[model samples]
Target chain A: MHGLFKWSSKWWPGVIPLVIFWGIAAWTSTATVEGDLAARSNAALKDTVLDKRRISVDGRDVTFAANAFSEDGRVSAVASVEAVPGVRLVNDETRLVPEAKPFVWSAERDVVRVTLGGNSPLPSSRSKLMEAAKANLGGVEVVDQMGLARGAPLRFDSATALLLDQIGKLKDGRITLTDTKVNLSGMARELGGREAIAAALKNLPEGYSVAVNDIRAPPYVFQAYKDPVALTLTLTGYVPDNNVHAAVVAAAGRKFFSEKVVDNLKASIGAPSGFAAAVVPALGALSRLSTGTLVVSDREVKLSGDALHDAAANQIRGGLGRDFPQGWQYKAEISVKPASAPVDATVCQQLFAELLSKGRIRFESGRADIVSDSAGLLDRLIETAMRCPTVNIEIAGHTDGDGDEAANQTLSEKRAQAVMDYLVRAGLPASRFLPVGYGSTQPLAGNDTEDGKAQNRRIEFVVK
Target chain B: MAALATFFWGWLLTAALLGFGMGWIAVVHRAQAVSKAWMRWLALLAAALVAASFTRIVPGRFGYWLDLFLVMFALYLCGCAIGSWLRDWVVTRSTLAARAAKSAQNDNL
Candidate 1:
């Protein structure tokens, strides 16, 4: 053992450097082989219609496991790998997934390319399908691997063409034709796309019918970007119809005083339930913000802005959600605007008028009790009052000629006092406000209709 | 007594090897735990000191001190380069292996 140790000590040091050099050479060579194999395999299979491909190298032998739609693809991949210079052998463990039946033909679209696969009845039909896809998709790559098969139903070309037309309307999804029974599953590119396709399918050639339609319409989007500095509200996205469009524009007009409404809305179908109910109140909330955005996508209302004050911000955050229709939700990102330089009494009265015009303070019928829904408007009034700190204002309450003059005057007085009391409780000085009642003496509109009466009975802030 | 002193230098070299080697291993195994670059530099300095002591390229105590300081700086730079290369290699290998495994599993399905 001692002699053996002496021999090993003498020879091992000399052998050590050689062993290390050989190890490095082998490691580098294997790394090169691995890298080369991966690159070559990817380049060869990239253009082929293979579903899944895995390439592994052990020495010079390359193993490929993949799924191919056709046997030709599998064979081609094996041949290509075998021809690569360093590869001694190719192991192809590829599979072929059976196509679904009644010979379903489908076109699938994604961000970049549209893949048209499945069975076609004739070679001419296949070419025509590819031509149509290329024509409609506009610069998107069209991959065609449609196979010729029998058993296509009567008027197959017409049905397939109809389905292909519908595919152009999809954002991402597949449309399939199974023996003249069509199945479509995907997201529509725009609002009312599903409805358009459904309407078109009703005119399909006789004997063809829809089996399943899983197509979904895009979100009912209503977005208004309020640029306070620009004094403009740019309305974009879809509204249900021309009437709804007109209503929304009028609502914007009522809420945003003197600001230009840049209407860029498209009239489309499929407005969510209670869309009007949600959007009208959302516009009211948005009007209270200094600069804000209101985005109503489906039943979700998202309002974000800098409010005029802490009271306005708190009211918006707390009240907007509850005002929406049942099952409607809201998210508010409200921040209080910095205190503005105090304005003169005249400007303060103008601001107060603008606030009141957007929304009204309400009271229980024939009583002085304020409705809880009027909190948002009152908050805005208080914010305006705080801005004009040096000014004293008279809270004048008016009534329509509906009740006795004495009772009307008393009720009006009590309502004006209620307004003053609310402002005082909200941290404003009571001395800054004077309550006054003008009974049924003066009217802005005729008191014949309810709307006219509603307009006549209002609370006005007159700067003193 | 002289032989014992030489043995002490050998022991110091061993300690230096352990310091740098263990530091490298720790960095590779748990990158977040040993994130400070200074710790890596200190370990490299320890390693270089032992190497310089063995080489004895300079004469006397001043030479020893100079060798220690200069070699520390030089090896710290070398350590950084080696550590970066090793880290990249490990990460690339892991990513490629994971991709290949996923592909193989999908192909099997």
Candidate 2:
């Protein structure tokens, strides 16, 4: 065994060929895997679509061909295929089932389309079919060709398009008319039944006769009842640091304008712009909003940050004016709320606590320049101001005793004014601001330790 | 459970292989001069500490102090792998070393 081990060591050079062979084997195996990966990455799901016709896909290529017209019947399936493994491409297009085109009948509107049939209605049946189509399909239009009867001119009502929108609420599965004699085809529930259907049909003066078809029966006709005049709107926005949310709900409270400008718009004569300025238009929309409320949830949107905040505010104002270009079809609802508010007692308390934790605002020794690291905290405060345009802001600066009381007062006032300038540039009304300096007189914390001193040299928001 | 076990095995094998290979190189330094390689490994250890501590990979909640704990765990695994590999290398070289020693002795005698 020892001799063999020695021989194995001496003949180790002979194993060079074996090592080379193993290297080649490993390389070949690796190449095979690489090829598999390439194939998987490149492989595409072949599509063989049959949309009333035939479409075949091989990799990225598509081939479309149609077979003798109607033999495939109504091809209703919009089936798509995806690539599986191993096989590069696979598709089956040999056989396909024919679909049926069912006659669409409006049992309540008293209309039905014989789109695929070849038969004409009698003169008496002509008006009956037209009437059926009219009473059944709302504003969608009613056409009765009466089976290729040249120039029969299928009479239709354009109002059919807007009628069925209300029937969506009727719990009764069906509505039956027996007077002019017609059947309404829809699933109505028990909550609103035959009497409700009668009430709905009572107001239709649009040149048509409709009546109760039956009092009780399953698989019966149903009128899809619809409510004509009802709509809803929602409001969302940010508030300012010191702003308070008003609890007044601005709804369509007996306030309808006698003077309307360019449709769906009614405004007071007291608008800053003659009801047509960009601002006036937005204000006009805000007025038309039949209902509004203010809420302060964490709107984690970028509405409170940099250019994004301005962009968000612009989007809010701009969206109001154009929420409905076709005119406020239904009584419009609107809300113009703030981002955050310190003028709000509750929010101010929370914000104060937040600032307290961020190492109470301080200054650089005896200098009036604000410290650098606390810039982020100031940035957040500024962002809060940008959110609520409804409230006025006051920057009250304070200090701890070290210098002459008068000089301290002057420095505190300058510091307060500096913050105001930043806010004004950042887009706040200067008229809505004031700066006050409290020099060493009012300290929320003690003046003994560094921490207490830091707390004393601070600023806060007081609502105007 | 089986898939998870397989994943654990894969991680273990990769770590073991890395440690085994590095351990052999470290041991071979005992036979030859490889001060630069030793320093490079030492630098890698320091780098692992810094990367794990401040690089946000471990996260603030985990705290940076556990960096030494993780490093020690890694070193222990590496040492075991290196020790095992060294044992194997010695076993494999024993007969050859013996043969070389005998041939050289015969020539001298």
Candidate 3:
């Protein structure tokens, strides 16, 4: 041994080769073993739900560290690594994934995009939720900020899917799920969207319950505008049904006799109760104005327009709410139309002639009772007379010469007086109106034909 | 773990082999002077390795062993120096102790 220990020149060169060869052999062998063990162990844990996995092998012994969702999962993961071929031992550094006490998850929407945040039970669930958000909210950007955690409720994926469906209906709002309870708050995109979301929540999975739902629907609106220049009473916005829609249009036609009715109302759900009843009275007040707009939103009635005079404005302001049903509110922004530039008797007479030529005042046959159909024309006559405030006007009543002459004369006199009374009730002084009876004597057209008689039977306003 | 074992064994073998080789060259061949060019080349190689290790520019998982090899190399150089000095002392003492006896034996022969 001593002789062998004695350093020799021949042995020195041989040692270099020997050491080099041993180094190469040792490195290659150990690398091969470590690499083979790692690959097999990783493959064994491929199907397991492990997070932040780290595996180190030391001569067939494995040190595995990871977060597992449950105790069973942690044990199973370690065992799977140990069962890998050539793995002699497994040092489990694994622990159960942290429990989320409340396990809150949320999806929020703004104008531009929707954001999905909070914890998810699994990676698969996280991706699934992101995909589901994209699918539900079309054309809206979906952002994901979810992390993995344990202690999620049973059927969490199903509840989240259902909740995501409601997010699309919201214009802007947030939906939060803490454990098995759901809390939602936001504004709905449309009028009936609140009810829709409420109805949808009823279908949530069995274990889940709603803790708070504060969705608000947009206002239900019904609007009418009277454009005097256009001679149109335009009705636009929502009505309860086709019947109520037709009723509102018909009321507008009746109230605004001279103005053409342009119906543009849509029949939709979520109209306030008594919508038609409220709209009709509101339209009546609107028609009494020279030009007006009526808007009914939810249970509130808002009428805005210029009344023909101060008395009419006061009447509308005080009387509009009286006809509305219980629980209905009204706000009248009534202002009297400014009095027109005073006109001389000559211009007022021509204005009456032009107005009378357009529409006739019809009275009940043989009696002096005026028909309600002529109220619009009477209002125009009153409005004209108001312009000629200083001028006294003669309200002449003519007959068609069909009835008895004495009786026609008496009826004509009474009808003329009724016209004077109507003008007086419309805030015009009674002294400005002089009742006259022409009977059949001053007929403008021959009473031989029905059309001639119809033309001849008229009430003429001659400003004096 | 296996990589560590490999590195440890390689360090021991290299140091032992280099020390033995340096001792034998010093004693038997009577060569005390080292080539300056060889020393410069060794210094350049060691500097490059140190820079690589500090910058972590060495690639592959096995590159971690570079720092270990550097330390081993430093120890091997020290072992070589000590081995050569020890070898020289032993050789000088043995030669001096046997010189007179060998010379007289030659005269008799």
Candidate 4:
């Protein structure tokens, strides 16, 4: 043992990281598979939307009894049948509901995007818009609005959203469109400062400074980094000025613990129990946090910031910190804020059984590929798309800073493209889908740790 | 890992022996010991690689960490080994010729 120790002292300073890398690689390598083939074609399924159908059930014909038909080949509709429980050989026609098509469903016929920037309307404004679009995106079809509204100037929310969308699509970290209302998130102080966020916001259409308040210190000072993040703390009540340095360090450790937990949950907690299990350990430092409420469960776990007294029973799961293997923020919020928040009740029952997790399907690290676990959630999205007939989708991808800027850009684009491919394969109109990638320039969450990174690597759906 | 051992172990051992021999020569002849010092570094790295492979069979989390450290060091040492070997070779060749010429010239004197 002494000899071994001597050997280690002389030659093995990197053993721990290598082992960790090896173990994690082993655990996650099993996670990837050669494309888990979505049934290529749904020929067996029926698509009878707008097509007339006559069916017989139990030797009896049922005509027009609240009939249902879908154009997507996956979903099957059954004839409605109400029969007495004890009756034998009752004549009833009930069709199986058709499997939903993997695409975005649109409800409106005319979804128009009016871009005000570079809006020098030509002699023919309608054709000009189409020409401008065709120059950038060839073969994209647009239905002409019979009477189009005059394009308005890009300002506030509109400009911010457009710029934010652009910033989100820039994989190389240079494409930025900043606004005061727009907030760029996700960064660890150790790697770089908040300058990237500031830089992103600076490039907006004159007079818009993006918001970076999320990383700044609170007014009363619940948490403060002594000299910007090498040390930080979140103490209850107030900071004792005399022991500020030590107190901050303790708080930072707490914060780090909680942040890691949140990120882990954000990444893969498709179930309520899994969310609780992922979050409990991070909360130990936040003693005041007793009853944690899960605001959103299923594939996406948007934890609620509520007290123990107001915690939801099944929604608040506990003891998942064992798998955290990372750190977090101090004095973490117990649940999502606001009592009136809409909490999905389905997740509390079966965590992995995702009903609506499309909101937070994150792409994996340094790549555009959706995580393996995203299949079920993405499938649900495809089903919803099939049900909604006329909608067009913008498959937008986002990333957090943890790699080379160029790589981040490529990954973001690739991820969006992946979603597009999935939707098209699922029988959505190829023309209806748009794929775009936003690198680490735009962030919904802080990009400082494992947790924040997980939150930032996500895709959004804008119904057009 | 097994391949790394077979691939790099002999060269590393040779570097270690060359380094030890050079150190003795440098101290006796007032020559620089830079080449020798680097050779020892290579030997230590080779030893690390040998130690790191134990992770494949080792139990416990701590062992895993240890294995990582060992592998990194072994790889680093291996990188230094080739350069160190060439340096030692150059030094020994120059010193041997110098000693032989000096002895021959002294005999004539």
Candidate 5:
């Protein structure tokens, strides 16, 4: 036993060095092989959307772990790794990305920005969706909160692109895609925006359908403002078409009798039912006011201003709603204009003289139809007449001598009556004014030049 | 678990064999006996190591190494106890058999 121990001691020290040398050699070889396999595997999956890739090698065996977006992608990744030249056996720890049973995605819009949320099947698809949103929504801010996933329906990109187009038409709303079904709800940006979106949705990709579309159109509005100072009824906002627009202008001309109709209205497609019928009465209510604004939005008529008198205001408040079509609403915030201080007949005469000196009352050619150009002058005259409520006044009219004496006299009388009719319509008592005509005899200027003739044809207000 | 065993069996078996050889040599050669106080301290130390490993109070890759070392150590200690018991049984049986043989020779004489 002693001789055996003496012989073993000499070899034992050499064995330690040999064991360590082999250990290091084995470690270096394993590391080199693992690094090489990892590089090859990474190259195989570089173009694919595999996440959290890890590769380890024991001799030629490989353990590959990654998150793959689809079962096919997972299998393909494993197969590719196994196909690598040095790989003997593959330990597959590859799992599919989380599958959304009813894959839901949404784009929501608020006042400031739009947010896109839910899952996307591929990174490329996610990037495409982001680009589409930014391109379609103009300068609006876009936020992306989408996750990578599997089980997205076929043609998802096509369907999502179509829905994103609809989102651009919304002022504020949300559009959701669950699998191949779509749900949309929100207010449209313009009058015809809702219909436009509905029409566009018809072009959605095949196998896609609308589940719930509750998009609401903006109110179809028509607005008019009566400015007593400007003597203009400004027509603004939208009209149904050119015909309705012209009709509305004509109605304003007749009802507002004394104000120039400044037509600022645009022709548009979405006017509510009974829009023309509703607007005529709303303009009538506005015309009864000393100054007022009328807004016809959708099926509602809102009139606000001061009427010429307490009786007019009360009449407007009580009667405007009754004149509107059924299923339409009316709101009148009517108040009476303050009555002017009473003035004597001399002061009333001076006020009328002062107003007429600024601008003369005008008539249309040879007819007694009062041209709207004289509306500002006539409104001031009526306001002056209103100050002397208890006094009597005579409106005298004279024509140029270019025509026959009898015809001139008849034209002058009709013009004088037109002036009196305007004042009476302005809530003045008809008995307070007497209209008279002179047949080119009472001329303030000569009968020679055009300017002279224009001056000679005049209407004067005299207090008694 | 099977993969872990396949990876670590070499190290664990080597540790157990080393412990068994040491235990067997100590029992057979009548080496200096360890005191109860030393045994208690070693047990406490092992318990502390187990606690640290289980709670993962140690950090980084070193913590993993410590856990693996503790497992190997526990197996080695189990092997040492079994080896010591086996050696004692073998020694006791041989001594009894030798005594019986000597008595049988005396009776034959």
Candidate 6:
């Protein structure tokens, strides 16, 4: 026993340290193997388009826990984990959550063909939908890619047919049918296409409802062209009513001064919202260009012209966008008109009249603040005045008969001064110019009409 | 009875101390490289010795074998737990250091 104890004591010290070292080595190998397997599993899972939120690694084993939107996604995730290097086994804890989305079906029309996509409840319903789409599209290739599923609302056939009928009215747009909810988005084919579709929707079958009808009518296009050589302003396109028509013509007369106004504007039902408000201000800006076109389509105003001077071009480019009503967008293409040869007083006066007739100087309503659109016109006038350097010119401001005569005169005088200030800023000698305000006493047209009132408010240059 | 009770108490205390020692060794070797199979065998041997020491409190030949098996099994578990823990610590520290170095290099650039 004594000898055995001696042997044990001698051997135990060496054995303890060796054992500890071995234990540490074993642990390191296990950890490394597990970590490598986990990394490989993660990389494999990433290659698959499955949403793997958590991954755990055991020795030669990997477990994937993820949320999948479909059965295919769940299967793919499991297969991917199994394919990882050193993974002997895979534990798939993936759960499938079928996409909970509205039952949507759409038919999109392009120039050459119509493409149909989304879900249909029944096989018969799919064929019926395709037939209807083909019938309405007429001669356009119909590519059907709609899948069949259960759970369509009742009266699906009649509702789809009604929607198909309205598709004929659209030039191009998507129609979405979710149960009883119908949403239409596209441009209308005709002038009153929106109204026609709305009227047609009212006749839908019982229990059928319209959720969102966003069909836009064709653009209500209003165009005006100013010709300085002919002293004529030609107006075209649709206006809302007869009253607006007469007012627009009279306004043209007032801005053109002695020039003739040609009215060819037609009365139509579907002018864009805020058409009247935007058109008048736009016209005021147009009157200031030498040879310019003002085109108002829907809520978009496009003005392209040559300004009478450099400063006017800058002002018009910077300010016209601001002059538009809120939510209205304006694009200006203003370039400076080239300087004309220096001329005598009489010739300069004629040039001024011609330039002014091409466009009008605009002001803020009821204020002397010159509207930015008027900058180009003022610039041209300044250029003409500079040519007749020795001659004194008079800047006259006039107002319509809307307000008190004295107040109108004061407002006109301030506006005239505002013009003179702009000219001085353009390097013109203030001493060479006189500002005068003519109250509503001088009527270019009767103030009873909106167009006439627009005409009466004017700014003129007189070579003194 | 008194002897049996003493043996039981002593065995319990010894087992507890042994467990604590093994745990400490695991922690110490966490960042060290050692053979895993050798460590597992050593743990088995230690557990068997512990069980044999407690066999004095047991009466009968069956108790001896039971004590032997139990001690060996417990020691095997201890070895595995300690070894695994150490390796994990080493790997984790090295990975963190490498990441930090790479980040510093990027920052310098």
- TM-score to true structure, per model: 0.56, 0.23, 0.66, 0.20, 0.63, 0.46
lDDT of 5 by residue, A1-464 (tens): 34222222222222233344335434444455556766777787777778677887655467899889878888989999888875556789999888898999899999989999998888889999999999998899999998878899999998888888888999999999999999999999988999899999999988999999999999998899999899899999999889988988987876665578999999988788889888987887787678899999899999999876655677678977887788999989988788889898899999888767656788999999997535535656777788888899989999998889999999999999999998888678999999999969888788999998988899999887
lDDT of each: 0.74, 0.40, 0.79, 0.39, 0.79, 0.71
Residues A338-414, model 4: lDDT tens digits? 33222232322122123334235645656566653344245445544544446566777777888887788888888
| Residue A211 lDDT (model 5) | 95
Q: What's the C-alpha lDDT at position A76 in model 1? A: 85
By lDDT, rank the candidates, best first. 3, 5, 1, 6, 2, 4
The CAPRI class of candidate 5 is incorrect
Tens digits of per-residue lDDT, candidate 6, B5-107, equal: 2223334334434444454344434334345565568768766666554644433323333443354335544444444455446667999999999999999
Docking class of 6: incorrect
A366-426 per-residue lDDT for model 3 (tens digits): 8888875566567678878888889998999999879799887888899999988877877
Each prediction's number of clashing residue pairs:
0, 56, 0, 53, 0, 11
What alpha-carbon RMSD in Å does predicted model 1 have with respect to the real structure? 30.8
Residue A284 error, candidate 2, Å: 42
Better of 5 and 6 by DockQ: 5
Which scores better on DockQ, 1 or 5?
5
User: Which numbered prediction scores highest in DockQ against the true structure?
Assistant: 3
DockQ scores for all predicted structures: 0.01, 0.01, 0.04, 0.01, 0.02, 0.01
- At residue B13, candidate 4 shows an lDDT of 48
Better of 3 and 5 by lDDT: 3
Candidate 2 wrongly placed segments (more than 4 Å):
A1-349, A356-359, B1-109
Q: What is the TM-score of chain B alone in each candidate?
A: 0.41, 0.37, 0.59, 0.34, 0.86, 0.44
**Model 6 stretches with alpha carbons more than 4 Å out:** A1-106, A115-157, A176-179, A190-192, A211-222, A227-242, A258-273, A297-300, A349-381, A393-427, A434-464, B1-109
